[model samples]
Target chain A: MSDPMAFLLWVKGPMFNWALAIFALGTLARLLEIFLLGRRPNYAEPRGGEWGPGLRTVLTRSVADPGTFQRAPFDVLVGWIWHVGFLIALLLFIPHIELIQALIGLGWPGLPNPVVDAATAVTLVALVATLIHRLRHPVKRHLSTAEDYLIWTVTFLPLITGYLAYHRLIGPYPLALGLHILAAEIFLIVLPFTKLTHIFTAFIARWYNGAIFGRKGVQS
Target chain B: MSEPSIERGLQALRAEIDAPVAAFFSSCVHCGLCAQACPFYLETGDPKYTPVLKLEPLRRVWEREFTLWGRIKAGLGLSPKVTDALLAEWEELLYDSCTMCGRCSLVCPVGNDLQYMIRKAREGMVASGHAPEGLIGAAVRAVQTGSPMGLQWKTLEVQIRHVESSTGLTVPVDVPDVEYLVLLSSMEIINFPEYLEAIARIFDHAGVGWTLSTDCFEATNAGVQIGSKDIAATLVQRIVDAAVKLRVKNVISPECGHAYTAVRWEGPNLIGRPYPFHVYHIIEVLDALRAAGRLRTEGKETDRLSLHDPCNLARKSGVIQEQRNLMDLVAENFVDLEEHGRYQWCCGAGGGVSSNERADALRRAAFKRKKAQIEAVEPERMVTMCATCRTQLEEGLEEFNMDIPVVGLTEMLAEHLVEK
Candidate 1:
């Protein structure tokens, strides 16, 4: 904890491993609980099939439904921006791709460093806007719990720290990188345990919604 | 009935926590976008009306019993428990404020089925004795008598006689192996006998074989609205038994939203078996007859007409386009509400809200959204297929002095039918 170089090494080695282990196992356990609970077989004859509609929903739900865009244009726009930016920065950045390649043996082409940086900057601003909106919007403010704010912080910290580390803006390179990695480790560990689990469960939920509505012959 | 207790409520909640429920709970990030989709929330501007917030008690039970981290927190006395106090607090949110319109389900960013959860949560609420008295009374009458409104077959028989006398067409009774068995809601029987007469004329004109059953004339299921599976099963079984006795190929649910939903969609699941006969909303049958070129129409109404799609018929059971098809045949000057079909705002009297007297004021308040929609369209007459929606529209428009007369789609369609 005292020496910056040694701190970086400890985080990069042991802490990273622990974080990954917890992330994988915790997410697995959460998903297993949902699947194991099992849905009852619907006895009614389906007017339409579930598979096509379910998959369509998985893609279509990414956009706001009709009237939703008109009612909360700000929320819809900002939500799309942050999610798209986050995905670009996470999946298209070189360093993140390298990390994924190292861990899962999956590699893909990464965007330019400047492009990644731009996405990170916009996503950071969107996250801040999201925080403000959550605090100020009556419905969001009322619905939010302490865990919601905590998850927000957990999600925001890693991105901010990573941005700072990439630019080498804080203290020393090793210290900044160490802190960024440490924040990310914390994020990975807390994700499956908090509302952040939506990262995975949202698709499952959308699929179920689509499938049920589809079987009823409704395009939800 | 014995007092419904917290133990039974918790057990009910636990039983209702299936995969979709679990996924919905886990996926909710509390963004509160669902509030924007809700008529009650939009009209009242109450954050408490947020669809996700109404499921708090059920969510607590799911967390405490299902999730690993939740179990640990609960064991350590850190997580919240589902209590009678909480259920009591949510009764209004669950029953009065919500119509189970499924709009919230359609608009949730993460695809959370808030309507489904609310419906499931009502099961727990009823088990805890937190259900509104009006709904409880309706359920009682529904079980003790054949109708939720306590209308006996004698009453429907009177309506049938009137229809027969007026149309000069015989109303079939318990006729075996009919093409369809038509079931009427007490609301339709009491408030709108024209629905029966219209169907009689239409069937006669189309030469469609249909009959009324003496065994289970009532179509509405108070149990489905009350969220009691046992009661729902009993009502559904009666319909199934009647349909079986008559040997009907199909059963046509009258112009009632919940009745169609109960008998067509939820009936099989509630009875734990697939129906031997198929079920259709009256609109669907009429549309099919029209499609088959059997329904010959003579003329269209010149007045401006707009259609109100019942949440159950359009959103819940996918009967949206069928109504629109019927509207096209009967109305020369037809208009649609800005928010129509699957995404339409509820009439605020569905899901037992109309039956629950405690919800009267809230239901009226929620109707403001639909009122605004109707004002925008300014139809000469509002045509809708659901009896509950028709009643609510009539009452709501009258309360607001909108001067709009609500009419049944079937009746209006009958008015345009060609005479042989």
Candidate 2:
């Protein structure tokens, strides 16, 4: 419905280019980290049967136990909501769709408007709630380093900008969309550097854990 | 209930430890990723009992004393009150609930050592006379006497004689000029006598010159478990003194996990010098034997066997890989459970939590994750390297009504070893 050429120009302009450059540089830095630090494997060896069983247990226990949910209910609730919301927002954003469309020619149907809108709203609310929780909780506050706040800011900014762009509440739609894309690129670049790197490493950590316990005959 | 002298001693220790304990709490990021790795969290799903939440009391202290905001909060008397009830809750949270499994640290992106933090917190609790009565009493006895269980030298001599008769191997105690001095926990001599037989069989089988000490025989350092570094050092010092007297080249730690940490990591530091004799965990010794082709294992017929990595051996001490190497030699139907190495779950026994009756239900509940791992393999028996893990799993599995039998790797090795 918007002017396609105008949107492209804004996305390709100096502001977007600078953001893309920084984003690319940040991503490169993250990749370099793996090489620089070298791979430190978690000590446990892989148990052959562990992956399937461990996954089943993790899934079942995660749902069955309300105690874990109750212990830090607000924290867990916000954490899951933010994480799922952020992921959906990343995947279903129009620019991501365009990229996917360019690569695979739009074979799949796009996410429904209501789902995207809901995820976006939830992401914004969850992020703010998490930030507030971090500030107010004594343990969290004591533990919150400068880098932690920086990570939160970097993560939250793009989500906020993308929401604003989607709502056409910030300047023009094209400008907002371009800003959102730029913010996203920045996020991707920083993903590996910040605590966000846990995204890539969590499963690896989990699998490593499973394998070790499997070898030792302990439960993962 | 109040022993003023004990109370005074605790107050002094608490005063000494307050600052370092406070600093450790200030270091966590509170990401809650540690939840997924903790078996206790998996079992009860209690957030307050999660490894991170156990650190909250210390976190509050950190905020009050160290941080600007915390100081401001404290200045205004707006800080969360650390009531006697809160301290009591923490005693349950820190000791009863946590196994100090080190899984939380493995999953921690920041490399925050939650086990160490928990151990220190326990130590602080011990200092404040808030530790579980059983753990503190054991530590106190170990300090007063040599052994945590207070088995006299004569009882230790009788146990050694049983080992001598059963294995037909002479386990010379208090012998001078032994090249290697093997230190064992009282548990091996009392309950798990097979562990002694296994060690004696291995040492004799390897033709390695090693002897057990009559004076300082026990290796299970309850001080390490209860967070009494002084008592831990005192217990270890007896072994070190024996080693020095016997002129042993190596101090082979028995199959106890915490014993290895007490004697290996803290021993050198406590003694204020690197040990002249290198310390070797029994698994390491066995691995060396297998590696050198000095020992061979006859593969046993079994439906399936899983390995339970003890938290101290796997995570705290970095001896995870060696155990796997030994397992390969012993089990034909060995099926690995998930999260084996540094990431492995605890046996719900470490950090003296195994001795705490109040934590028993929580400990049993925490075994759900481990039980799920066992059920995955559909194994008949689960083997582990730690004696405590073996006991914990045996008790834990039974409490959960799992049919799996838990045994030590050494016991399994003794069963399957082919005489060279």
Candidate 3:
């Protein structure tokens, strides 16, 4: 256990279990707390129907509208690149696909190595661009708190370390791999508790806003 | 001296934290898209005026009070406290610079309702005695008198008499079993009595049965602007009780943006029951008449025209297309503003900014966004349905030295009513 390789094994086994437990239970608890708060039912006669706009907004809000796109195209463009690149880099790799298949009995052909390597490079660039943009823009800097910068760093560690391990760009290969797994574990552990909850809540918020505004007859 | 208490303010904020609010705070991605949508931020280049930034105090309160991590942070004295000075500093951000326009809410990638929180934050402002005196006085009058401007029934009666003499039409008062109970804003009663005359002439031509209730004629709720739900509920109760007493089939909210929001949207929620009758914005009623062939206009205005959408009406209430449909009947030369309807910018006065004299400079500053939109189209006249928006546009144009004259959509429709 004193060996670095042995430490990496511990992180992959016991540490993985701990991260998964916290991620699942914490997320469920936070979601329940929000739902239990319960809104006072509105008695106003609805000016428009709800379900149509409510469900529609959950999908529609994925892309910025023309007005919003005009105001900040760079943010939107970088944002989509990061999201798509991260999903491909994380989920479509051969080892990651095998891990999922082992756990959930789901498997698919992984993208070729060169393709994932390109996505890794693009994802890393988008993530760094986001950090620079956040720090440089006055309004973004004003709205940002310690939590925001911290989230950015935590979200960055797994990808950068993974890139380093895959390309053998720096450090010992196993050490980098072990650190990447640890960084991902930390992210999973913190996901349900922090602003990173946006992964789940953003959809619900859009639905609720759409429903309320929809009932008022606005296409939110 | 009766002063607002921190306890009251904190209590109001606590009361506002429901499921949606909690979710909104958690989901906010700090994307800064809302700042781009905010006219105040665009006009002043001030980050503090960002729509989401305006909710800092409220968000602080939510974090420290609601979230586990935030509560832990608070226990360690790590979180910023919502102190008296904090409330004072935020008063302008919450009230003066914001129009509760909902553009930020609409543009948010995560769907955080920044305007909703701003409105909730004002509850804290009012409770802590941090609200601007101009708005406080208006709310006080709205409570004591039937109208916010302290206009009496006699004032309306004189205008009604003048309208009668000029138009040769009776202004029905407290008529039983009328089809519509028309609620007027004091702004309309005081600044634009011609709106009443237009309604009288249009209703005569359209043959819509309606009356003005002396008991609840003023529809704009200062309590809504001031962000006190108790006071707002009282104002809504007056309208509800009057409608029940009058037994009218419907109530008409006229030529006022927030007035319609107050009565049509918030009214039932405030009063705790649906009204026996429905409510409609005057433009919606007119459009319905237009659809039914009950309205006929002699001719279209030859001058080029465009609409300035009031935030509460077009964006918040879904009264977008109805105004455009009505405009088509009387405006042959009408051109839509490039950013018209739901995406339209505010005239920067609807959410009680007009009543708060302190906000005059900031209000005018935000109006530049609308000014640019209107300038691009180069309209001969600006037509809007909301009285508060109309007032803001007229004042904003005058300050900018722009030669455009503004007219109410109802007045324009009245001008073209087919001669009976």
Candidate 4:
């Protein structure tokens, strides 16, 4: 734990194991609770089919509606920008894609360094703006739980630290790289325990909602 | 009834914690977007009225009773407690402010069925004796006198006689094996007698055989508004029994939105069996008749008019297109309120809000959204299918000093019917 090189090895080895285990198990348990909490079967005769609307909503609900966008334009724009940016930064970065490919056997052509760097920058700005937004808005501030802030900080740290390390802005490469991995490990451990679980649950929720509405003959 | 208490309320809430509740709680991003979609929040600028926050009691119940961390936090006094005071405070938010219009559900980014949870949350509120007095009175009258308005069979008989005289057609009562068994809301029975006359004329013109039941003609369900499925099931059972005994092929719900929901969507679920007869909103039946060439009308209205899609009819059930299709048939210059169909703004009178006096001010305030939509179009008259929406539109427009009249679509269509 004393030498910077040893810390980097620990962060990449045992620390990674612990974070990945918690991340995988915690998310699975939460997802299982939702999908398996059974109920009485619906007895009413359905007016229309469920399958079409069920999948339709899961795909369509990714964007906010116009009424929603009008009231919270900043939120809608920044939120989408950050999510899309995160995916790009995660999937299109050569290093991250190599890591994922080595583990999962899935590989795609990585975006250019400059393009990925730009996306990472936007994502970082959006994350900070969203934090400021939650602090400023009365309703959003009230709804913010401790977990919300914790998850936001943990998620922001890794991305910001990675960008800083890549450009050698925060510290020497090894020191900054160790901290980046450390922050990411924390994010992985906390992801499933917090609202970040919404990534897996959002579609399950939308499908359930849409199917019920569709069964009742309404397009949700 | 036993004096309502928090223990009973907690037990009732525990029963509603099924798969959907867990999933919705899991998926809420807490972005506060639903607050913008809510009329209670939009009109009053109150965060507590956000559809998701109104379920705080239910959410607390889910956390404390279900989740491991929630259980640990709750044991150590980390999570907020669900108390009698909380239920009392949420009663207004759950009942008075919410129309159960399902608009918030439509707008949720994660697609949380906020309206569905609000309906379940009312079970806790009612068990805690936190329901509005107006809704409670409606429930009692509905159970004891067979109509929430306390209109008796004799009253409808009088309307029946008046309709028979006006239309020169007998208003069939309790006739077995008719193609449709028409049901009326107590509001329609006591207030809009012309609805019965209009139906008589339209049915006679189309030669569509239909009958009313003396045993159970009331379609308004006070149980639904009060959020007691036990009472709702009891009322719905009466309609099922009547429909089954009469052997009617279809049950045509009157122009009452929740009545359509209670009898059509929630009825079989309440009764724990599939209905032998199909249920249709009056507009759906009218649309079918029009499609089949049974509904023949000669003339079209010449003024600019628009339609108000009742929340239950359009959003809750998929009857949106039927009303618009019917409107196209009869109105020469029909214009749509910018947000018509499933995205339509509520008249703020559905979900039992109109029955509760405590909600009157909030109802009018919420109606401003619809009122503005009307002004945007500036129609000469506003037409709607549900009688509750019709009544609320009339009252809401009057309150705002806007003179555009509200007419029931069925009556307007009857006026233009091809003469028998």
Q: Which candidate has the top score in TM-score?
A: 1
The pairs that clash in candidate 3 are none
- Select the stronger candidate by lDDT from 1 and 4: 1
- By DockQ, the best candidate is 1
TM-score ranking from best candidate downward: 1, 4, 3, 2
Q: Rank the candidates by lDDT, best first.
A: 1, 3, 4, 2
Q: For model 4, how does the per-residue alpha-carbon lDDT over A1-220 read when each residue is reduced to its tens digit?
A: 7677888889999999899999998888787777777656778778888789989989888877777788789888998999999889888999998989987899989999889999999999999999999998877887888878887898899899989988889766777889999998898887777777788888888987888788888888
Q: What lDDT, from 0 to 1, does candidate 4 have?
A: 0.88
Which is the leading candidate under lDDT? 1
lDDT of 2 by residue, B1-420 (tens): 554233443343333333223322433345765676677766775656557778765555545644444566688987774544565667787878877767675544333446656766665566666778878777877777777777787887777788789878898676778777888776666768788788778777777788877667777788778776667778878888888888888888888888887787666655566666788888888898889988866766466888888877777666877888887777678888765675566777777777666677777777677777777778888888777778878887887788888788887788777775
Model 4 in CAPRI terms: which quality?
Answer: medium
lDDT of 4 at B253: 94
lDDT of 2 by residue, A1-220 (tens): 2674476476657556665676567545543333333322222222235566445433332231343354467776787788888878777756667776874687355587678879989999999999998888644665566768988988898889888977889877667867777676667666644545555434443343443334434443
Can you give the lDDT of residue B46 in candidate 4? 69
lDDT of each residue in B213-248, candidate 3, tens digit only: 888888999999989888999989999988889999
Q: Please give each candidate's TM-score.
A: 0.99, 0.69, 0.98, 0.98
**lDDT by residue for model 1 (A62-153), tens:** 99966999999989999899889888988998999999999889999999999999999999999999999999999999999999999999
Which residue ranges in model 4 land beyond 4 Å of their true spot?
none
Worst 10 residues of 2 chain B by lDDT: B15-24
Q: Work out candidate 2's RMSD over C-alphas.
A: 10.0
Candidate 4 chain B lowest-lDDT run of ten: B64-73
C-alpha local distance difference test of each model: 0.91, 0.68, 0.89, 0.88
